[model samples]
Target: MQKLLEIKELTVSYDHEVVLNDVNLTVHKGDFLGVIGPNGGGKTSLIKAILGLVKPSKGQILFHIPQTRIGYLPQINQIDKRFPITVLDVVRSGKTDRRSFSLFAKQTEEIAHAESLLNEMGVWQLRHKAIGELSGGQMQRVFLCRSLMNRPELLILDEPDTFVDNQFESELYEKLKELNQRMAIVLVSHDVGTISYYVKTIACVARELHYHPSNIISTTQLASYNCPLQIITHGDVPHTVLGLHDKHQHDHKHDHEHDH
Candidate 1:
């Protein structure tokens, strides 16, 4: 696949301490990359770096396309629900690709585009409804449509499933899976279980960045990276059993490994 974004020896710092050190990764065409790690880790820093929100102290970020449309949904939204904003209005607020804006001007095309995305998200019927009146899941769908309004080449989401209902959580993933056919994705979350299943690859970010080729990371593998993450997995696996005479050691040695 063609490479879209590349980060080499990227380091982000605040004050004198380094948030991310010697971080490196590449985003390829149609790549759905999931970033998982601890709270204080530099997961958000990586995203901000890629999005050009934070200046890297050192290293280089090369974008294949000089002007790639990006859709971003942060973990915390600053939307004031108390304000009177309709679903269409919310979707319209994200149309950054337009050349000009005139309220009285003919915006039929833009309106149709927003409506189409709203319908795809199953919220077209609520287009006229106030954002404050909608449920959490419904509001999330509205934000999703807003993010998608620009038809971004890369979609960057930070814990998109935070306030969404459990049912829509899977539904949203399904939608994103279908959308991944055309665009690349980068998602940051602490939810290992669902992200492992949906994303094509996983990057475990601690003080440094470790890109795992596959999502099937063993609990031991996490410990080896000194990554303090909870591994949540499903299925029937036999637990280790020791005979009465056998000895099991609780002490484990972690192999220091690079992501490569």
Candidate 2:
């Protein structure tokens, strides 16, 4: 309920191209925010600025809690398949991010915690299996366990559903909803309409940013912000929002531009 994070007059640029422009936002405790935008949009840049991964061209990002209370799951976790790490080993790695805790000495309590998290993620049976042997969705579950191992108050997930499958898609959001009861969440994804049902608010990022306060949004509302995504929502069965008409229009425009 209290203000947790604030982004004021935020701007990020790469060689004057201007990836993000004068963005401003406020995040409160228990906020479940879904960030959606096109591929070349400034979603990644905006996230980087918030996490302090990249220097902002201008403005400020302030966090109410200690930086250690935040946990980040990057978009591409390019781990070498030959590294020979186990599922438990990867989950335990999250402990290293918390410098206050001792990394080397393993306590019986910590091992128990790791196993509990792995079981919750449905990968407890594969605890000792090589990470490379697991499927994409399985690996995502493992990384999620790792991210949550530290009990962070603010979790930032950049495209958490990238390599995820249909079965785990709903499950992941359900888990996130449960987690949101305790902490705040920021989820960045290309699937806007799908996430709209789960997130409390929607933030669309292009070169600029548009914040919609609720999950139920009209196509016109998105158009007002010049957001290019076409999201179709259903009142009964929740299905994918992207429409074929939008795709055809986009492709046609691309070909037209190529002709010139």
Number of backbone clashes in candidate 1: 0
Error of 2 at 96 (Å): 3.6
Query: Alpha-carbon error at 160 in model 1, in Å?
Result: 0.7
Q: What is the per-residue lDDT of model 2 for residues 141-221, given as tens digits with 9 covering 90 to 100?
A: 888888887788888898987877867777888889998988899999888766866887788898889987665455666
Give per-model TM-scores. 0.83, 0.85
The sequence of per-residue lDDT tens digits that candidate 1 reaches over residues 1-260 is 79888999999999968999999899888888888889889888888898899999999899985444788877746567888889998998888777655854537767888999999999999999999999988888889889887888888888887888778888888898888988899888887766766777778899798886664455666666666787553332111211111112122111112121
**C-alpha RMSD (angstroms) for model 1:** 7.6
Global lDDT of each candidate: 0.78, 0.78
Candidate 2: TM-score?
0.85
